[model samples]
Target: MKKLLTAILIFISLFFFAQSRPEIGGNFIKSLFTDHNAEKAHTYFDSFVGSQISVNDLKELYPQIQGQMGNFKSILEVNNEKDTYYFYSDFEKSKLDIQITFNAENKIIGFYFIPHKTFDKADDKTALKIKSDDIELKGTLLQPTQGDQKKLVIFVHGSGPQDRDETIGENKPFKDIAEYLLKNGISSYRYDKRTYSNPETFNNQSTVEQETIIDAVNVAKYFKANESFKGYQIIILGHSQGAYVMPKIAEKAQVSKYIFMAGNARPLQEILIDQFEYIHKIEPSKISVEDIQNIKKQVEFLNSKKFSLDSPTSELPMGLSATYWKYLLDYKPLEAVKSIKTPMLFVQGGRDYQVTEKDFNLWKNQLKSNKSAEFKLYPSLNHLFIKGSGTPSPKDYEGKGNVDEIFLKDLVQFILK
Candidate 1:
């Protein structure tokens, strides 16, 4: 999942448009994704598109989406809200919602593609209950029904309120990874993130150490104390934000190995700035100078020593409290990893836009001398470890794809070693 800066970009857009025009907008979107022909779709944008974008640009963008979401299926639903029309369309691989804003003349003025969330049916057989203090968390454990488990891997989620499956749009990358590990004779556990299960428990005062780290430590302890897992080695597979804090968890828990997937070594506030700058550079037409300035102001507030839990959250990015940012700023993943002695595997996606190749290199440069640390980089993979072509946009995460099989193979070897 992306951090504050990226989430802000996802939810907000500027448009110089008027009332909804579903018929025109819907057909226009269909023509772009369904026909996968830029030349044919150009007519729809002729009068609407400004000098900032051209027909050839629209053509290139549409075909790139086809590469990610396959062919479009049909429009599932449509809603007219405010001055915009929202069309939810089914694609061969995933469901995507397109929002189109029109000018007073019924010409399209703005367009956006958003991933639609899909909930999976509950599986009772894999369900497990975990108790952390007064709170009980529902989780799932995946393992071969008839085989002895060689190792147990506990999945730690990235930022956000994630379910046990870490479901993103139509893809459940964690579930895919667990199933693959189970087939290879490994057992894995994943639970609904604390924030997802108990939102009321978290407030502006809550820090990552309190909200995330403590619960992860408890989960590890719970498994280590279980009689069923007595003979198996314990592994902590931390992804993104989870990976950033794995070393801290290792300090408090008894885990054999740590797998960092799309993890970052730099401070989160710094990474957030990097993400904003990168996106602004890539999509200059979409990102306004005012937007960039606003983000910079937020970054300045985050870096200020006077910032505290009581600071106004309205000015902060991602609607998170100053306390949360303070905690992240205080923690240094690279320094934490330096002190950790446990065997480590850092897995990175070369095409990941959120946590880019720069983070992976930081890890390598910091831990290269450590004999127990290893690294793997997949050039085509994104933050979720799903393979895709070209530069990975957030839309690519909506596509139906599994965690790369090659990563699973490597993970199996790491476990056995």
Candidate 2:
């Protein structure tokens, strides 16, 4: 997920260190993988890192590479881009790619372990256009060839500039979901995200309402106004960040039901902190004093009261504008859910690292007494609702997979009921 990668990049880029040195970057990465001692490796990597991830986070992630990929072999290739270095390496079990970004002083400010590659599969698709206010976007409408077109679903993507397929690398999860739904006598509508279609519009000031909610509202209205959809039961299916904001979307868009897939009840920034800590908990090791201090400083900034619409991007996480953070901080998904009277279904994956079971439990606990709400948990599924074995990693998304059949069935049942 490019959006996921961008978020991580933002988190790591906050540390401003020294200038780039190819030898320094290469040696630092080599030492981290070969040393076999996270503490010792931290000494080498920490000095290069300004402060983006906690030493604990690195410790947990470092070993997982060896655990999954086996011992590192040799660096197959290295590509340099400005102050950043991209290293392609071979492991006993598989290949891995690592990216390191450096500051002017040659210190490491960003590090990333990219997951495996994704491949695209061909599917039958129908072209469509979505219009709202001055925005007109391209999209696809997928449906079963023989069905009565009784049920219609709109897929709203997670954060970032996602296309109608919600494409990540070669994988198109939304397209897969839509096709699966079509096979089951359901119709779906998916469009290129507003940001993807019109990046210039968001160059200046923007809010969640402007960027996402309005577009969603327009989509629903378009479907409703069309005579072809007159008798269909309309559903809004949101994934990840999309799910997080669905409740708010419901406030403006009149729809038959809502589906929240891997959604979080907590604020976005708070969830990010939890995600960082989860990375650390999975692997425990001694961290350097400097790294610990850096993590503390970063957390302090997120928790401070100094943030406002006018706050500089440098003060915010990922250098996002103040307007963006202010909207996320002020908008509470769970609070919005409390006022929504529409029937809702929550689906969660047990192995999902991004939006974990904790978030699922939060929704369950909050909506427990509401008979209008239902929940489903897939213990073997990842964030994309794709079933897999072993501990789920970002690599799981690299392969071709469909939304769990049971999940699609449940979703169909919910829409018809």
Candidate 3:
């Protein structure tokens, strides 16, 4: 459900300047949005920048930036690497890294807003590839070195272009889960999402079948065919959006079990609206009423059955095509679950704003007749199954944390039992 924001704006002089003050940088950024006062902002620019870049230059640039990132909200975090400081600024739409260096007078001498990157670690894992047709995704297979491996978990990522670790800010929940499972003698296989690896292959027309399901089915088949993995029970673990589509994947892939992590029983459109409303309630300024109305109009169109292939993608919610929405409209998770005979473990974070307790309850209620269906509720955890307290927001994900230990212990029990 997370989207990546990218920007690269750099203006640096050949010579190095003095240490930059975070307050100056923060205020200057605030000025850009407050009044768009290029003339005033120019005064904070160092001599080198002032000479080369005029007020008109900033005027032209500020509008372009606001068009993409919306109004600047606040500076979330600042990291210093020697003379350079990277300010993780939160905008209305997304977060960006503002790299700046100040002159001796504390004026802005060098500045940049580059793409954010958080490095992944996988020393204990073996690199592999999961291929299907033209798509070949880079992946990792981790096996416990100490104990007998009788099972392998295949991780399916949530919506968006996710890397192998399902990285969010500094957190790598999948990697953390993989390592924890490895310690307990459980092997895991995770790969970059198709949209992440081969973005060119997808467009607005692409549905979940193309973006997620096929690749996951292929991964299960790949492992099942391997001689080494012959007798091991293959468990498919789907997170968030992945969890919503787990039943479809389970139908195609002959996995022994399914693990739905923060999965939703409600339709995606409903869940999306709920997420926006929750964000607006907690932080009224972050999501505007106009935004909610716009999304609702799109949701109404999808439910109305008036849209066809001719419908514009721009008018659709999340810019997904009419075909994509149609697919979701036709397929119901609850109905899909009825056909899934494979044992399922539905887990949800009590504090998860994205997929809340309502969705979990829907799953529990709908699947109550099924003896094989199990459920877990981590009351203190967030969407990522990471521990946190108080009101949950996007800021909650910024802090570094791992999946709850208790959930992992229970997962092991479910798998081994």
Candidate 4:
């Protein structure tokens, strides 16, 4: 998901630049992929980057595009014909559409790309201004087209920074869900987490309970006061880490129901360990048992305030940060959700290595033992609940697809029934 964020940010930045670039931005992109002289390519791109941006910035997001994308010979085929193509050039596929259109001046005027049906059409968001405790939170209000004010849903994004759309991997999961729900007449509210645009306020921080919990509370408070949704019982839809945090938020916010999409049912540490093990099995792998054990040692190294973000690469594995690993392990979802009173719908995807079948089954047992939980598994779906096959990888998500059809059907049923 982080990988996808980098790509989307780069794509968005390029899209914005394509509008007013003094030099043809399309040509710049083409040169980036096709040019053989790494130095010249690097220099050309550096010359155009805005003053506020650093050369190292794009490097973090698109090192793969600049360094590795142009290396491979890729094949494109239709019927009996075989066509060879390189990426970064404009092209079309059944799912992905990309192009650069021109104006009279021959400068790149409109660069367009569309990813089709990227997620479920969530119900439409109603516009509402939610006021709370000297803070005004922007709310994307959703209303069911058919149902009475008895049912509504709210969406909260996963860990890391997220907008209302839960933007990741170059896909807008929340937008897709919002669009889908509108068609089905299910209402929803997805808002920006307090952590965003206010990171400095949380920089020194307090107990790091899920920040989205605050969002969940605020949205619930919105539901409480809004005349349009006066009689409805609010449901919270949380994805990934949001799932971990939602139960507490639901209880505190006084919501009546909750949904967990691609959620985990185990301790975060165990899940992270599982994720590492899954990715370690990939060819040209970056994870190993030795690395895992070394990472464990670094926990002590980090917690004692001895770790440095700038530690030499020789001290640790490539791209592994002690500070980040230490921080991630602290979240405890299983503990948070236990004994929660609200009804729940737990959705899991088969191909999702980020959160596995094991975690799903644990949730199944926990929910089954209780009268309030319902479970559904999509065997071919990935971490995003998108219909998928085989192992989950960075490449799989690049191809366009919607969230699982079964998940959509279940969502409609959950609200309707």
Candidate 5:
């Protein structure tokens, strides 16, 4: 829950690539009506992509998407820190809303086809509701049936304000993980992120410090003390941004091993820059020189501790705060990882959107500093550790896919041993 968590509207899954051709007089641009120019949507977003037109140019030739998508739709937003253009399409009373993110130059980084059901609106039957930390967080706990002295695993989700199941598309990833682990005689706890759980409570507020890793830390401690978890070793499995917080949680929990799931290996600033640079390439044509310059200034301003509180950067996107940026910049997980001699297992999804190969490599580099680090990457897996490639999308889960069997097997073996 970044400072302004309540402002966003979530939906949709379709993604697209921008720019049909190389440059100025490309045949694709000349014939914009053709399907060849329109192109089939891509599943994953690529950074360093060139655009037919950069997103900045859109202000010059803007056609509001609001009439079609509804109010509160953003024509441009951030991906890793670069401004990307997004289009929303809500059709015929269907619950699904399609939101596509673009680069500052206006190329498509990816799309989120948000499923219709919101957490508040979702039926309770779909979730195993629980309360913790004096906040009524929604989540499901998996119990190992007929098992004695069961160890505990806690599930933590990434950057977004996500529900307990870590729901995306038609999939509830945490629920899937919980059920699978339970079937294998392991007990697990999964909970909705505070960002999503109590967005209104934090309405119009939150810089980076307001949300992020600390919630997961609190959640871990809450369950570890539960009567049901009386005699178990608490192991944490933090995926994506959750991974960013895992080491901290492990430090606080003083528990067993930790599962690093799709965590950011680089500093938050570096990752954000990389994400933006990637989008810059795709829509090179759509961007204006002035806009790029402004973005650069903004990123630099964001990274600066000397930045003024009154700066315009504070109002961007989710209103990401300077304090939050400072905190993230100051957060060094490896030091925490190094500090703890706890046994560690690393899980990397090969086709993740935000976490790239470089990120995993960085993790490897840092963790190797600790000889006790255990690492495994599933080449076919996406950010969620479910399998996919070419552009991982939520649809991957809706039709068919399983979290890598080996990842789970190895995890279970590690815990059991």
Candidate 6:
């Protein structure tokens, strides 16, 4: 998806103005995607947006999403909330929630594609809320129909503003994992990240602690205090970014065990550089040499003393503020893991470029002295723990794929054992 994928996490810095006309907003969105016209779409973007995103970026992103969701049908409805226009659009394969943020001049400044809200509740699933102080997060709890609810897996989201399902394009990895676990008599809970459920509180100055750990700690505490789950083992499972913060969550909560699914042991700044390099190697056309150098410069600047809380967010990678980078830079994941005595499992997908074998190896090697640490590696799976062949690129995240059965079996065994 070119730089668009890179810019997916980029924080918008502009002060937005409201637009009352859905027809005008609808027409702009139609022209942008109807023919997959990147050039035409680029014309609508705010001038400041040109630096971080390019027409080529839009060109690369459209096809990747379309490949997953199929061709766009039409905007079924539109809702304008202040500065953002939310379009409920129909695609061949699914309905999508399309959002566009406008500048004071009514030019497009931010664009995002989110899955339409669908609480696919069955008899085994029940809706719930996890309360943490003033913030309340909506969540889902799945209980096995035939077994004792003596154990519950608390799912912590990887990164970004993810829904409870952890929906990525057409794939819902968290939902798939939870549903499969229920079939095996395991209970689980998954919730929307604070950034997703309450963005105003999250703001742009959030750290990994505020973004992930606190909510996770609260979820664990909430369940641990519940009378129904008395004597039950509360296990926390972290995927991707969740893995990075798992140890801290475990330290603050009364969890029996923790899981690392494609977790990273390195700092996020380093991982960002590694990911950009990996993408550039596999799909050179999508990420240019200049793009690589630019990212490196941002990372380097972030590491330098010149970076302070007052530094411009626009100059930083992903437009994240200095506070966010500083928190991650100071976070020693290895040190964090070593401090926790709780039994842990490290699961890695060999094909996952985002959190590669290099990261898994770090966890295994460093924790080798800890008998409480266990490991599993699946050679054919991608970041989502889904199987794939050939070189895995950003394209792997597109389309439909379920978490591998073998991996799930092993996960269930670990939880039960």
What TM-score do all the candidates reach, one by one?
A: 0.72, 0.68, 0.74, 0.66, 0.65, 0.79
Clashing pairs in 1: none
- lDDT score of model 6? 0.84
Ten consecutive residues with minimal summed lDDT in candidate 1?
A: 11-20
lDDT string for model 2 (262-318, tens) is 998887776666665655555334334444445556546766876566777766665
* Residue-level lDDT tens digits of model 1 in 178-246: 988888888998988888777789988898886778888999999899998887889999999999898
TM-score of 5: 0.65
Using TM-score as the yardstick, the better of models 1 and 3 is 3
Best by TM-score: 6
Which model, 1 or 5, shows the larger TM-score?
A: 1
Residue-level lDDT of model 4, residues 86-176, one tens digit each, is 1233232222222344344333333333221111123533545565444555557666557444677888778765667765544567778
Task: List, residue by residue over 1-417, the lDDT tens digit for candidate 3.
Answer: 122222221223312133247777776777766778888888888788899988888899887887776787878787675667778877766676788887666788888875342223455348887787688877888888778668999999999988888887667899999998888899999998878767899887788999999999999999999998989999999999999999899889978999999988898889889988988898888898888998899888877767887789887889988888889988889999888897889999988999999999999999999999999899999999999999999888766688899998988888877
Off by over 4 Å in 2: 1-125, 280-299
| CA displacement after TM-score superposition, residue 341 of candidate 1 (Å) | 1.4
Q: What are the lDDT scores of the predictions, listed in order?
A: 0.80, 0.76, 0.84, 0.60, 0.59, 0.84
Instruction: Score candidate 2 by lDDT.
Output: 0.76
**Cand. 1 TM to true fold:** 0.72
Report how far residue 8 has shifted in candidate 2, in Å.
Answer: 53
Error of 1 at 376 (Å): 1.1
After best superposition, candidate 3 residue 279: deviation in angstroms? 1.0
Task: List ranges where model 4 is wrong by over 4 Å.
Answer: 1-136, 144-150, 195-197, 204-207, 286-291, 299-336
Query: Residue 345 error for model 5, in Å?
Result: 0.9
Candidate 6 TM-score over all chains jointly: 0.79
What is the Cα-based lDDT of residue 312 in candidate 5? 54
